[model samples]
Target: MGAFGRMRNSLSFTPPDLQEARLEPVRRRIVFYIPGYDPEARTRYRLLFVREWTRYTKRFGGGRREISRAELSQDGLVQSWTVSAPEQGDGAETRYDVLLWDDIVARDFARSRFLSVALLIVGTLQTILSGLLFRFYRLSWKYGNVILYPFVMVILLAALSVAIAALVHAHLGDWFGHSLGLPLWVSLPLGVIAGLVWIKAIEAFLNRVFFWQLLNDWVFNWQHGQGRRPDYERRLDAFAEHILSSVAARDEAGHSTDEVMIVGHSSGGLTAAEVAARVLARDTSIGTSGANLSLATLGSGLPLVAMQPAAARLRGEIARLVTDRRIVWCDFHAPQDWMNFPGFNPLHDLKLRLCGQPVANPLVRSARFRDLLCPETYRRVRFRPFRMHFQFLLANERPGAYDFFAMTLGPRRLREQVLAPDAYSEPEPAVPL
Candidate 1:
């Protein structure tokens, strides 16, 4: 069998072997999950998680994994779900409280078209400059491709813009002036407006293919406040308070708190890291006192922003996260996902000159899509890199080393599963399957 064949076979479903995982005492759990640059309502994510969990239960639930319908909060920013199953030959219920931070991303999508276009121009230039510098640094061959693809796409867009302008002037100029009997001054401005409209339309079409909105947002935030948005800060504060409250409730009830895992996907990776850093900032003994705090950043785009020289504030936050021994940070990267910088290390890649002592904490691991999907499903979506990026949050087609639902809702704690001896590694891409 080839590598792909082996990967598929390895992921084939087997009866649930509860013995493979070390059983932990039943305790309350909390997860603060942040989605990518998405503008969809929180209900969308709620349904998505429900659907994925349902699929997981059908596949490997072994008629044991039972999940409750996700109950949305009145404010609609938080959702809570409960999962129960027999573990270690004992029946115990695990309460999974998930808080989704999504307001800022929706606000980003609601920006005026005029402002979006203006920011696009500025962001495009910034992206080109950053790409060139990344290539100059010789980070990786993949980095070169990342730089080349966007630069080439932008050039193509520019060429298309020029072509549309020329076509408008050629076909419409004479007709407007003579047949419509419009003066040259009036005709010229109309033609220009028509050309600009065509360009904007084409830009919108290209965005579906290249995801320019994410790039534009990243650049805008980096240049503006280095990924610091007031709404995001407010939400982060709320999340921290929720964590403390959950821990407090467990304490008052005389139950031990299991774990608090902050999961960030795509751009949410950056947000998750910063939020965890802030929580530590406010209370340095948070993880040490009660529940173990952990961070799982899946398909994170941290390098996209951190690579830029203007991302000083973000870098500072990252450096703080690195040295904080209380938090367990596990960064999962997939080589197949072009949306994230696979195998990139933020501290070394950004070349941070930190003011405080630096420590290596984030153990980079590979979330291989090949191992997660069936052969047919993997082959079908392998070429659709963007969809593959989202596979991080969805249920695995077949269980293997890493399962998102299992991490969040399974019997074992995040720290127990991820902090195992072979569960961590330095920043490096997993070998392609």
Candidate 2:
């Protein structure tokens, strides 16, 4: 049996029809994927994309001929990878060039014991205060849960600290008195050392729950001169310039660069939007002159940053993108993803109050994990909100509508796939009992 037939028989749900759109020769394509505040090596994301793409192609029927090794740019801020694949039918073979724009400033923040602890403490306090002042707790119960997570961690850590201190005092005190003939001073220092050790031991885990990177980036970037990270901003500018140059090069070579897509997940959403805005700022005619420019933001935590009063630059970027009708911005929101402000419109909610009329550039759409995953798998992960936040990148178990791999790797144009009148559907609210 063919791969498509086998995939069809093996799956419980129907996949989105990739053949719906007219098959065209895909000559050139560029996908710039900006990840959230993650310090892990870029190789991990490449592996993830390969795995998900392999699964998607196997299940949905396509062939990937080659995937290139990671090639780092001279500045070390950007990494590029390529994949060559054929369309489903007699369509053209496509080359997908993926660039990962990484600016993980939190890696340094996380390495230092004092810095990590300070940021976490400050981040926790800031989150609580922000929640109360902004009424984030009432805006969404998820924000309430986010606010409570740190306190819960604190309580757990406090209990653990006390227990450790008591254990050290009981056992080490006796050891010091009898064996070493030391005084009570030794016991106090020992207890203090033990507490510090405990905090260090759980630092990485604490980072995951509290999202220190996300919080720190938001707060730090809002500061004057973006916390002295001019390089970070410069890299973003370079990336935008590179994108425009690449598109122009492809066009000048007489190749049909069908689409240039900028995809960002979580905090990266804001970054992606900013990058697109920067491109527009550099070349006002980018969207109209060249290939189709598209932005796909998955589980965007844009509001978290844009809501801050200090985020004037980010707010301006968002405002520009929202007002520009040339760029197709598709914001994918999952109802179960608590990390992001799902179904929240940044321009409207942020109250940018533009002088001119607003254009509906971002067609906010709902990505339902429940429909994408099988019932058993869905139930297993329904309560795990963090995992669900990443479901946007994972391959669907039972496809209903949205397919991340298909949109990025398949033959269909992003506009043909997401710009349908019925494509952007409102998520159904729960029926009250």
Candidate 3:
């Protein structure tokens, strides 16, 4: 009993110096921006930072917890790390630009992964509980035409769903254990039955609040002086409009842009591409004058919409815009990822079916392709095969991906050297993800 208790105590977060355990992978990569280290501006290079740390963890919480601290530091810097782990424990970590772009890339990536899991887990549970309470409701024959009340039920279900999510979230410390949320299949019918008011309430309070706050802050601060394709796309036209409107008053300042990039990941990738296309279509509204643009898409599922001819045509329009804008499109897709299905010729679309019977996931059936795009522009651009969708912004895994992103994705000044001198100067070499 004492031994077990003592083991639990040692797990608290603590700094590197005070650690009783061995120091983390003593090896460190000095991740900073190329021209110089600007913690705020370097969010795009965050991949390089994350690429360096995925394999390591160190004890951090000062008490008796074993939480690992992902650190950030540099020249004349103190021992500081930005822990992007959210209130709900998720695998995603966020990259922030503490001193350079790499930090931003790392922290944001972590955050994204964290949210993805939360969405799946929380969303599933919320859907299930809602399904049980509402879908399986025993409509009493007693209170016919009584006060119509979805509000009370919505709140009750929302509260219960949140409670369940919170409970499951608490147990994340126990990895390698069964997940605390509802098992698969339960979420679909359950979530569908949950109703809009309840779903939105849960989404707003639990996920949206956390996601939007952090992401919005990063966008407003890090996106200035960035170019098309070179920078990560995190905003919608309305977001861009706000920024443009704010800056419209300031001399419409001129800033030299070496490169411009727009990056999208998973669903975000789709949103990013749409935003970039709109911005490109209306560059005058968002430009800081004299800025170039490049387009980089990671884990793209442009093919998902191909199942519907109308949607396929819409994506084709976006594709054409990418090419027409003369912005190079490097579409990355991975086969192993369950996040996106249909792992082949992107042009061909597949309808989601159940046991060979057509079933509909409205969201997918909606904007994913045709739901959010223009058909004319979607047809023109080509999606080259990229197998590793999960590692879209990964810095070191695939040289082609790394090069396309780090070197070619941004404008002249904003870009970094992705490949080693040997790859650029040398002959053909086998590229792997």
- On TM-score, the leading prediction is 2
The sequence of per-residue lDDT tens digits that candidate 3 reaches over residues 339-415 is 33322222222332224322111111001232112344223321311223334443332223233222321112211
Candidate 2 residues 216-246, lDDT tens each?
A: 5444433322334465677678778778887
Each model's lDDT comes to 0.64, 0.65, 0.32
**Candidate 3 — which residues are off by over 4 angstroms?**
1-235, 242-252, 284-290, 304-323, 341-389, 397-433
Ranking according to lDDT, highest score first: 2, 1, 3
| TM-score of each predicted structure versus truth | 0.79, 0.79, 0.33
Candidate 2 regions with alpha-carbon error over 4 angstroms: 1-27, 63-65, 85-106, 130-134, 166-182, 201-231, 421-433
Instruction: Estimate candidate 1's alpha-carbon lDDT, on a 0 to 1 scale.
Output: 0.64
Per-residue alpha-carbon lDDT of candidate 1 for residues 1-433, written as tens digits (9 for 90 to 100): 4322222111111111111233454355667787776666465777887687677656654336566888777777677777675454332365655567556666666677556556555665666665644432243344345434544665676677667765565554566444555556766676677766875667667677664655455544554444446677678778777766766777898877667778888878877887788788888678775677778899887766666667677787888777666777878877677666555665546676656564646666678778778898888998786788899988776656677866776545665555452453211222222
Write the number of the candidate with greater lDDT, choosing between 1 and 3. Answer: 1
What would the TM-score be for candidate 1 when compared with the true structure?
0.79
Candidate 2 — worst ten consecutive residues by lDDT sum? 4-13
